[model samples]
Target chain A: MSIDTSTAARVAKLARIKVEDDALPGLAEDFNRILGFIEELNEVDVEGVEPMVSVEPMRLKRRVDGVTDGNQQDKILSNAPDAREGFFAVPKVVE
Target chain B: MSDLTKLTIAEARDALRKGETTSAALTEACLAAIEGAGALNAFVHHTPEIARAQAQAADARIKAGDAPALCGIPLGIKDLFCTKGVPSQAASRILEGFKPEYESTVSSQLFERGAVMLGKLNMDEFAMGSSNETSVYGNAVNPWKRGNDEAELTPGGSSGGSAAAVAADLCLGATGTDTGGSIRQPAAFTGITGIKPTYGRCSRWGIVAFASSLDQAGPMTKDVRDAAIMLEAMCGHDPKDSTSADLPVPDFEAMLTGDIRGKTIGIPREYRMEGMPEEIETLWAEGRKMLEDAGAKIVDISLPHTKYALPTYYVIAPAEASSNLARYDGVRYGHRATLAQGDGITEMYEKTRAEGFGNEVKRRVMIGTYVLSAGFYDAYYNRARKVRTLIKRDFEEVFAQGVDAILTPATPSSAFPLGMEMDDPVQMYLNDVFTVTVNLAGLPGIAVPTGTDKHGLPMGLQLIGRPWEEGDLLNTAYALEQAAGFVSKPAKWW
Candidate 1:
């Protein structure tokens, strides 16, 4: 699956990064190289193997399900660019 | 003041315990040091009043005989960790004005133990780069010199600031997180000792997640003993992080005997790749020789699947990061750009993210999205997962073959020029080749400064141990560190 300029543009848009028109070719080339390298995985034989979650064969530690927050909302929201009514304020969308 | 900046955490703690020094004095000394060494750009944010208040609290605790092990000890917290009131941007534009309602678990634990906070230190944007140059705040200069030249050099990242701050004596010790040698590489470049503990040993609760599974918070200090003491204080089970282990934390400080009489250490044949610099190889050999002289059996072993680590890490880390970072959509946290001409809600999100994230972060998210896309998921992400198993199995096989630990170079080479590889992503990614396998296998690894390269920049010898065997790893590192005797001091005495 070679990445062309159009695919590269789509990927750039999806990733939310702006690439100038002149830079698109280079970006596409880089993307193609990465995809080409990834294609090498097709050669490996993993017919019956299970995906490893962790290197150590131990189960994840279970914790009691709880909903206790750090409770410093006012302090945390102090750094927000736009906050109103105890929540982050964004441009009205539903209206 | 006896250059309080030069004192280790242990020394500082002792002074406070003996009533020979006050926390206020220590904190003031550190602040002065930071001011004097302002050129290093080690700190992204400093709250002197907050530090003074905390120091006073620590002093009160000591007077009441309720002092913890690290009481009154000043330390640097990496900017990547969220502080309740301080800006925690992870050195990226996206999180420019983001603060958290919670404190990172490790830093909070340190604060509870009476450690005084110096401030949030700088790091690569989203902890992405090998050099600190990627930071939005600016690059942290390496404290060590290249001969008589004083021009700025890189303090390795993404924990570059933590390492540089400690090396330059701005703090006694500092907290650093290692995703793929972030702590160790910086510690090596700055000529300090940093350890990345076994996976799940440290809680990941409030750490700005880079690569979730690979990230482990640890201590970077001037020496092994301080690393041990700080590591003990930082390691504990936190219920907030699902991946955190519930195992009983060990007494790391108490376990440091500094004796490795009859231990077995392995030198993996696979780590000596073709492009390894001659100086690094020489230093590695010198390290092995020192360990052998100390009565440790050195054997040659093979991790056959070593080369596959980088590619596997590239696939898996991005996949996880893509998922984790999705929460930053214009709706909740971080810098959200307002809609421009002809832009709607969805376009706002796209524009905001585009404007917020740096080039490197955007590249990673793009790569991550590509690998996990509908048509590529099984081919890329799943295959990478299987290869990850092989990498772990390689470590398991060697450890099972009576090898207590493996030795390798922490990085392929010493720190490169600050902006040398900024234009080439592949070259930058290769800097982590030697470190990523350990993270992939979830093993404990420590980077101990061995000696300098021909250019006078410091290099490190990495010691990797089996899972949950940090005790053995540190003990071996202690022995080798004693024999290596690499004493590094910053050029400027700030």
Candidate 2:
């Protein structure tokens, strides 16, 4: 499908990235090219093929279910721009 | 100390063991090298005092006969990995000042083995670009040169700085994460050796998630053996990473037999597409000839689903990435923007995220969100996943037919000009076509320098091995590396 400027704008909003109104055309063009490239896959026939989870056929290794964090909360929060009461502080959302 | 900057981790360790060099001396050498190469833009941050203190501790440990394999070995941690007390922005304005209290599992593992941190290396914003040009911190220059024009060739990202630093002798070895040729391509571009072990080989606990299912941490180094040594240290079971395997870690170094006698190496017929440069084809042919001369059998195989790999990866990776990066909203961990006049909190959120992430990152996030959206989920994401399965199955069938490993070009072409992709997203994505499938199949692959192209730019040969068979993969790469006899040194140190 041809990606229009409006579609491009929606994509940008969905992606949570800001793009100027004038740049939407370029974004739309880029998206169309990517989609065009993706369309090339439709020609390949994968009838009985099973999707590969890994190069090796071994099952994923399982670990014991446990709840232990690295416990460096203060160190982790050290770089926060806004912190309050030992948590990341943010602008209030509710009245 | 015999110009410690040029020493490999193995050489440094031997020197330390024999009391010929101290960790302090090694660390100082690296720090001096970093200072000397300041214009290369290889580092995001440096901690000389911490490095010196760590080096002293390593010396004390050596004196007490308590040294681990990596004790005192100075290495660069990619800025993408979280390092306690150090800013760990994935080279984006979104994470401009973000730091983590805990070190990433791979980094911490290296530290436990006593590797001294030289500093965090630079990368593309959120590991998004092929060239380090996407980095908010500026691009890393290719250590190698063409003429007097040091117009700063790309070091290849998002692990560009890691590859450049190791190649430039700024660090003995460096950590790199490969999601889709990130590590291998850069390694190839910079004339270094890098391996992306089978997915889940290294825990991804604290590393910033890129494409969680495909993201894996590995080592970038001057030689295959050093890569092996670092890989050995980096692999282990970590309960914290749900996807991390609990399998026994093998002694990768011990398995480097250097003898590929009678091994069957598959040369995928599909990899040599029409547009591949003649020089790269020649190099691939030369690599196959070298392995055959070493008594290995060569057979032509087909990965029929090869063409679908790039598209499948583009869809799956972005789909997962969008979900994984959702946690980075301004309220929790990254930059926040203020609402404009007449806008409210929701608008504030919209503004913060839009302003925070870079263009490529935003593109991926949007692609991901679109594919995962209710209406398109089946048509895009699900279909891509099915194709991914087919790609994986193709490798499985080939390996099942007595092929010990597969050999192909790491990339279709050599490093393009720095700004070549700024106006062309398709061209940029094509750069990863050759390397993305291995990740999709969750197989181990390594990129070794094959030879230089006509333009004198370096090209690489990628070796794909069966799942968890990194040892065999490295062994073949080591043999080819020895036979190719392509020793490359970057242009004169700035």
Candidate 3:
């Protein structure tokens, strides 16, 4: 359960957070402390227990596949950092 | 009455109806209180113009004899809620300058009932931290001082500002979202009444999601009855939020008959953790006696999975937070990072997220991503999910044995000093240890402030009810409130 620098770097990458090399040790230490606390769950036997994904056990509601609302592109894009030509603007991906 | 600001929502409603006061005057009084209590930093945004308009409209509606339940009542909204044109940051720099165009369903419901919104309250960044220190604005100072000491104390989090506002009488009632005791813990710390209704009880369409499965909106108020009254307006089925319960919204206040005769309240033995302070134990016992004197049978019960709740909540809440936060990449909405030479979209996302999120938020997102990674999913994420089921079942086993409610202390201890809980995340996480199990079970739980510690910091007793049974839970808490006679308020130090 001990998180080393390499594993901490990998987790930071997966989370899309850029952790400096010096910060990796601190991150690793934090992860280790959290994991150490979490390891207490190993005491109980959960062999036959089912996982609870949500408090409400109901099925997700099925919706009609019709577009009941649309054409508010300006409103949706207003909060975007960059928008152009009625679309969300971002760094070039295909280039 | 001397101060209209000191009145509870119920009392304010009566005053408005009897023509003793107008909503405009009450709103002005609350706004003045917020201005005066600037040191506490309870409010992050001030909407005096909006408040005046709503209050005047409420007066018009009342004169027309068609006033709604919450007409003219001024309240504080947790920053997590999307407040139409107001900035809703969830107390994070990531959402700086972003104003939601549409109203969230919960706030919209209150506004529809003619409730006046004073402003947005502060909270932990994305409701991620227990202490209010994580808020970008600043930590919210609790109105209660420790034994006349001048040192500031935390109001608790992630709904810290809401709790402080209600406690300081800046607002009659405030809205708070609980994902692992955000509402209840602060309510307990600040000596007020707060209830986290069933998971799907209130619509989540507009509240910013932290842990989607566990996040629920409820009322933070001056007393149990005010909690009941405000909670009814905040709940309803919304097509916008599919998870919103498709059930009738009950008149919770009307259901509070304050009679728990023949009721069975369970005392979960597992909640008696080792090293618990003697004061918390005494307050819990006093709560039991109060219920027993009210004719309810107190039985010993065991929720065996209780100890695992904190760890389980950490895993599940972070995993969901990482997924939900992925939408905040540079391109669409929120803060965006400037690109460097040869930077691509990946760099844009990384820099945007890393720069936008705070230290605690980054820590959680990293933990979440690590646990849900391909190799570690089975070990961490799935294991915690299973533990969550066992935790839920423990409550079921107790309730099935004719237990109408479970009673325990709301928090391990009352409000500690602001920066004291920092440096150790586990020590901070322990604040929610007694409260998280209720959220994991998707049941209603209320924190009723009973008495104070030797330091004069307020302590609370929690009562947990079966799913969608807040009416019964509030009635039980009402009986306790009557017996405890907890009329002590934090002396105006703020």
Per-model TM-score, in order, reads 0.96, 0.95, 0.99
Clash list (residue pairs), candidate 3: none
Model 1 per-residue lDDT tens digits across residues B1-494 = 58887898888888888999989999999999888888889987997887999999999999998888899999999998988878898998888778787799999999999988889999998888889878889888888777776556788988999988998899999999998889888888888999999998999999999989899999999998899889988888887887777778777767677677778889988889897889988999999999999888999999988888888888888788777777677666788887776666667777778778777787788889888887888889989999888889888898888998888999888776677888877778788888999999999999999898776788898999878878778888998899999886756633
Q: Lowest-lDDT window of 10 residues in candidate 1 chain B?
A: B485-494
Indicate which candidate wins on TM-score. Answer: 3
- Candidate 3 lDDT score at position B449: 95
**lDDT tens digits by residue: candidate 3, B379-480:** 888899999999998998988899999999999988999899789988999999999999888999999999999998899999999998889999999999
Which CAPRI category fits model 2? Answer: medium
* Candidate 3 chain B, poorest ten consecutive residues by summed lDDT: B325-334
Question: Cα deviation of B135 in candidate 3 (Å)?
Answer: 0.5
Candidate 2 Cα errors over 4 Å, as ranges: A46-77, A92-95
CA error at residue B42 for candidate 3, angstroms = 0.4
lDDT of 1 by residue, A1-95 (tens): 88888877877776656666787888788777666666666666778877887665667665567766677777756766677899977665775
* By lDDT: ranked, best first: 3, 2, 1
